[model samples]
Target: MIHQVQRSTQVGRTTHSPKRRVTPIYAPGRRHPVGQVVGDAFIKHIAFSKHTLRSPRAIAFDVSTLDDAERAGAVVAEIHDTESRNVWTAPIALIRSKGFPVRRGFGNQWALTLEHWSRNGLQSEAEAREEQQAAKQAAASVVQLGLFGGGL
Candidate 1:
């Protein structure tokens, strides 16, 4: 099923809303329990979103309400970005033997968000792979939009 919410573009062109995937928060112990944190991890903030990956800068955040979110069937982690001293929270899972996913709320593109989230704290190669994939997808979408007159 397609959700049809229409909005006017800058050029007054009508376009259907992009497909959105609402992902649950990243809890440590759903499929598997949280493993002992090895150490302070230095992971890259990676994403290829609709909006320019702005400054790729960081800022502080307060995730004081996630406990209440559990009742809604999701979990979150408040992580501080040491580089920018920013704290961020997201509804992504950090499963054992898996990568952590923290969406920057950039777009509704699930694939775009997935690569970054999965690569955020996983293997180093994850960043490169996800970034490449997201860039390709974003480029493809742009071409599609251009070809289709920006409706799809």
Candidate 2:
């Protein structure tokens, strides 16, 4: 019967089968777990760039939101005397790292906002001074008590 059907189909007047479309599986936004993988990807692509890690004259970001609450993010950097700005981008999955704070939007979509950009570096003078003060305070709190006077 199968051979007969094959022959008949070859002869004439056969209906063509529709092509099956494949949909991709994506992590659910509401419960998606962002972990080290996401953070690593973000750091490798975005944070590791000298243009991003170093202090630029100015920095800006453009975020385009999608229907699925996915976003396309880009960092724009303006360097002194540069004719064009440098643009850095990272995967949406990476940008949605667990470390970042996200909020629910009007449509119950998750969104992250960029507030400021700064270089990653050691502590500033003021911060160092404050740290030294804290250390001194901690040391002062330790009492000598003169051994035998308290416990020998």
RMSD (Cα, Å) for all candidates, in order, is 18.0, 18.0
**Candidate 2 segments exceeding 4 Å error:** 1-41, 44-101, 104-118, 124-130, 142-152
lDDT values, one for every candidate: 0.34, 0.29
- lDDT per residue for candidate 1 within 1-152, as digits (tens), equals 11122333233364654443232322222342111111122112312232223333222111211322333334443344445543343332442124322356532221112333422445334467878899999999999899978835
What's the count of clashing pairs in each model shown? Answer: 10, 0
Residue 75 lDDT in candidate 2: 25
- Candidate 2, after superposition: displacement of residue 119 in Å? 2.8
Q: How well does each candidate superpose onto the true structure, as a TM-score?
A: 0.23, 0.21
lDDT per residue for candidate 2 within 89-115, as digits (tens), equals 333543344113323232323322222
Cα lDDT of candidate 1 equals 0.34
